[model samples]
Target: MTHIRPTAAPATRLALAGAVALLAAACTSTDSGGAKGTSTEAKGAVPAVSAPPSIATAADKALPIDPYLLSYEQRDQLERADSVLVTRCMARFGIQYQAPPQIPGGNRPRSRTDRRYLEMTADSAQAYGYHGAEGDRPTPAPPPPQVSDATRLVLTGSAAANAKSGQGGQDYNGAKVPKGGCLGEAKEKLGANPSNNGGGDAQLARDIDAGARERSKTDDRVLGVFKSWSDCMRTKGYDYPDPVKVLDDPRWSSPAPTDVERGTAVADVACKQQANVVGVWFAVEAAYESQLIEQNTTALAQIRKENEDRLRAAAQALSS
Candidate 1:
């Protein structure tokens, strides 16, 4: 999934952080398409639940697209701007700050989406089975140079002081730490508010996500592919209702997948390939998103304008 760092806005920074984490989770395959599981039938038929198309349609109309839900290039520019700001902030205190090295490839979605719902590639399934690469991914870059207590007090204001004082610290060096400290200042300098278009964007994301999952539950195209996958799993002695059930199986909850889990995962991928589950689901989701985007052209255009403005501000901030 795309990783947009949260802004340090006083009212919504924490909420945005939580939302980003949730968005990450949403784009991953960890939650069985982000739907709760139901008991499987002995015959492997999934129960159907009808969804309203209006859910997707309404969500798109109600909220503006977030300017910060940026593409990889935009995110890179923002990160650079952030690094520059951090370096300047630290320099003010006579501290040299070396920005953390960027991850070699940087973070970009491998596909149109994060492939969370449909992540099992033929090779991935054969090699690692159902286990995700979360454990195997590269460690994060080391942090920048550590700051001294005095400098921390200057940057963070009272929060750091209160942590040391056993009292609420709201000010630093006799001044309140801006909402998120120096980091917040950096974000503000770039003209980015981490809040979701004043919270509307966040709600829109939730609505769209929920709508997509609901569609997955009942979409005829998805169900047809799922039936084929279920039949294939049954041949392998697994009686799963759908791909979601395959991951949601309690037996796969161990630190490492049980042998059965691994085997089942391999079989699951084979069946998904045979049934073309990923292709069908991807097309369906793209269609839904296209409709949403089409319905919100004005709002999305406004968001684009805002993003352009912020990028311009970031450029000025860096040059200055």
Candidate 2:
């Protein structure tokens, strides 16, 4: 349950090339139903999607306890540990490395169960249209404190080193940069390397996410709701086949939403509400995730244990 402190600039952001692109396409709206000051709870009989006892029970089960999904807290702790190691190593080279300041009040954290489309509430739709309120959110801490040229040389290793066949590619003070550079050394010390599939945890996390997205696209229940939503949009003169398609519309690319985009977004939310898209989609995905979790219990347990050990080491590094 250790919270991983986020870095001023997360290197993981760079590592997750494709996954980050996928996330961008799946961007959630700021106005989750609760945040919009509106209620989505049904006052009477639940829709077929919410009425099934098995689905209801599954939905109630705590989500994202699976092996692959690292809780925000765990991710933050791991990042903090990495930063601590990096700072310590830099200091040995006489480089003053200041860790980035934490956000005053952290931005709302996304849960593993939370879906991008589901976050669009009627209230949010009415207010911001399809343009997400990302600009309104608190900015992340500034990039890590500036380093002098000597420090940068040590941290990045030398391009000149690659060229030099001998002398071990000397860095400042003729020191050989450790294999993989300073960042690699920090990761080695922490026993955290997402790029290496032999570790399995990072690769598994990516697999689970990719699997869910794929399943969602083909899930009968989800597709059914999407059809209803699409039909509703047709009545309103919009031609999007699904929510994802609607998000991809070029009109939404502007810094601020255009009237057309806003109007379409509002209608989109209305259709989603009318069709109970979020409720149905969530239940179906929950079932899928539960099955995946059951199939990978042992692998997940090992990942969880490794995470714990990493955090403990990170704590020690920070304290020291």
Candidate 3:
């Protein structure tokens, strides 16, 4: 098994598109679950949406993973060896590889059986050519853009929302309202808050506050996700191979591109092995974000505006 480095994906265009996507989605969803009685805040107006309580109290809400960490080091390593690093990475993430499973109980098969099993699996992979690991061999390029069927599977497969909804399909766990298009009924009927001044449900408020603090610590978690993916690849022998040294490696522009891409890629490889894990990760983040934004839309809006500028710069940097 050989390691392949991943190319850096261009960041600016990617960020710009994401920002625009969020903005566009916000404007269109009438049921964004904002102040229902009040007239929706005019988009250009100081967005009337209230900031979450956590954002105003000098508490930090954890940001999601940035996703642009890899620099094509993994892809280069695998490509040069004429092995399918992506497939191997996918295998680490849990895609079915034709290789024999580690059977316990010393169920050692006869040599003939083992060879027959290996040959069958190898033929299946060769026929499919996931992520073009086999395509690098002397074959005409299957298609331009060269995205593999596995990659596509990772993309269109269960999105991040499916697993987050608990008993009810609409909510992220009935803890907060769905921010995006998520909707479902609740499993447990929620109770009303008790009065304060030694009269209210102090425990409930404390629980909510604690969750806010935990969710705010997103940077480390996001980094861990990247490290986890990289480590998984390494375990499968895609050990961060340097793309620069690999002959004719594609010029990727960023580590993982962005949080969305990183999540999608993780889902692609991981979900194949562990379905709904990606959706769960996304749903947790989304639900936390909803709570945080409910208290601090102003700050988030400001960051979002700056994000547009940063994305433009990133795109320009990549283009240059």
Would you list the C-alpha lDDT of every candidate in the order shown? 0.50, 0.54, 0.27
lDDT of 3 by residue, 254-279 (tens): 33234333333333353122222222
lDDT of 1: 0.50
Candidate closest to the true structure, highest TM-score: 2
Give per-model TM-scores: 0.63, 0.67, 0.21
User: Per-residue error at 88 for model 2, in Å?
Assistant: 1.3
- Candidate 2: list runs displaced more than 4 Å: 1-62, 65-67, 99-109, 134-150, 156-177, 194-201
Error of 2 at 242 (Å): 1.7
Sorting all predicted structures by lDDT, with the top scorer first, yields: 2, 1, 3
Error of 3 at 280 (Å): 4.9
Whose TM-score is higher: candidate 1's or candidate 3's? 1
Q: Which 10 consecutive residues of model 3 have the lowest summed lDDT?
A: 183-192
Error of 2 at 98 (Å): 3.0
